[model samples]
Target: MFELTRYDGRRRVRGSIALSVGLSALAAMVIWVYPSFEAEVDLDQLLAAYPDPILQVMGVQTMTSLGGFLSFELYTFGWVIMLGLYLAYSTAGTIADDVDRGRMDVLLSMPLSRRRLVAERFAAMAVPIVGANLLPPVVVFIGARLIDHPLAATDVLAVHLLSIPYLFACAGIGLLASVVFDRAAIAQRVALGVTFALFLSESLLTGTDAETVGSIAPMRYYDPNAVLLEGHYDLVGAGMLVAMTLAFLVASQLWFGRTDIH
Candidate 1:
């Protein structure tokens, strides 16, 4: 199991490291620029001028503080869209690539069970996502402190810590797609489409009559903006994310267990 996890981890390690470094730099840069915004604009007035839908999509409620700014500029858009899509793309090929290349037969011929194989591969997918999620908060925290904005350490920690299950749920969707489709490209497309669509639905339908529809999206329960900016950690929301992730993983295991990989 550990070997299977390491094998997948090694394949994606370089790319994951690059992404983490890039996000950290970006977070620092974003925090660095916060002072200028504070000096220039009447943020509350500026934010109020935007339509509610735009504000909701942008994830900026109050622009009076550093936490709100970072939540809006860095975590909400960058992590939700960029990191989420990257995970989908990375995991979408995990199972399909092996099957497509005829490596699944050789692996299955060994002592590995199909259920264990899928679980280990999913665990491997978590490595990059967890690493990517962990690095940005440190950069953001240090940058905030350097700029004298001084976000609470607990808020900084909560933002990244709570995001893990969300990323896992996103990866689980891709893993399920990878096993269902024999072609990696097709799996990737499906995963990307589903993930983005869910995000868009959550973004658009939230706080409206159609919120029930949005509730079905995994992204609905994972709001780093709430955690980082408002200091509101939704334990129930985090629990829901965990439940959804487990559901996806179980479905993946069962599906892969019954799959006919030639």
Candidate 2:
């Protein structure tokens, strides 16, 4: 099991490193420029001019502070869209690519059952996602301190730590799509489309009478803005994300186990 996980994880090494570096750099840049923005823009005035729905959609209650700015720009948009898409895109090919390239036969002939094979492959997807999620907080913390706008360390830590489960859920969705679709590229497209659609749905539904509809989307549970800016860590929400992740993984394993790999 460990060997299978290592082999699958090795394929994502370059991508994982690149994503970590990219997001960490972005976090540093966002934090580094806080002073300049604070000096120029009247954030409270500007944010107040916007409607509540607009603010809700943007996942920002305020932009006058470093934490708020980071929540809006880096956490809500950058991490949610960029990291979420990357996870979905990467995981979408984990199973589908092997099956499409006829590599599943050789893999299965190694005395591994389909359940273990799919579970191991799905589990390995966490390596890169978790790696990419970790570096940004360190960079953000350092940059914030340098800029004299240091965020609460616990809040920063909470946001990143809680993000893993949400991202894992997203990857599981993509993994399930990979198993359902025959072509890796097609699976990737499907995963990307669904992930983006859910994001949009959640954003649009927020603050509306139909906000309950957004509950179905994972983004509703994973609010970095709330965690970092308001210091509100939703334990129940995090647990729900974990449940969703497990459900998707189990479904993928069961489906892959019963279906024809070819």
Candidate 3:
């Protein structure tokens, strides 16, 4: 029963480590450069130069402090956008790639049910998602200490902890795509496009009459800036994201169960 989950998870370990290390390195760089950057430029004036909509989209609340700066420069783009897109793209290929390469037939011929196979494959996504979220905070904390920045450990922890469900929700989008499309490339492309479009819609439509439409986007729930800068943790939003992920997973399982492997 757990064999498929363990095998798929092990397959992802190396890539997950690489992703974790790369993000950690980026976080270190961002933390290392903070002091000099703050001294040289007027962050307020800089933030003021951008339009309000642009600032809102970027999650750039304040850049004067390390937490705010990291929230804006690092977490917003690196965590929210890049990591979300990467997971979506990676998971998007999970089922479709096997199906496209005729591997699904072999797997289906085994004792595994279609629903169980889809569930296990999707569960394997936890490897990368957990890796991506785990290592960066350690690096950021050490970097903050070395640089003499008074970053709160609780805030750092909160931001990463809150991001788990959000990342899973993004992966859920890809899981649905992986089951919906027969070709790996098509599933991956569609998943990536849809994820990015959701992000854009959430960013652009906020506070407008159509803002409720963006509620469906996972980005609308996770706010790294709020967690880091303001120490605000939206437990309800995280719960919603968890619910959304389950919804996607169940939908994928149902669709894959009905899909003809041929």
Clashes of each: 0, 0, 0
**Residue by residue across 45-123, what tens digits does model 3's lDDT show?**
9988999988978878889889999998889899899989998999999999999998988888889789899899989
Candidate 2 Cα misplacement greater than 4 A, ranges: 48-54
- 96-189 in candidate 1: lDDT tens per residue? 9999888999989989889888888888886688778768888877888898889889988888888888888888889989999999999999
lDDT at 257, model 3: 87
lDDT of candidate 1 at residue 27, scale 0 to 100: 91
The per-model lDDT (C-alpha) reads 0.85, 0.86, 0.92
Candidate with more favorable, higher TM-score: 2 or 3: 3
| lDDT for residue 172 in candidate 3, whole number 0-100 | 97
Which model, 1 or 3, shows the larger lDDT?
3
- Taking all chains together, the TM-score of candidate 3 against the true structure is 0.98
All candidates: CA RMSD (Å)? 1.5, 1.6, 0.9
| lDDT for position 256 in model 1 | 91
What shift in Å separates residue 121 of candidate 1 from its native position after superposition?
0.6
Q: What is the clash count of model 2?
A: 0
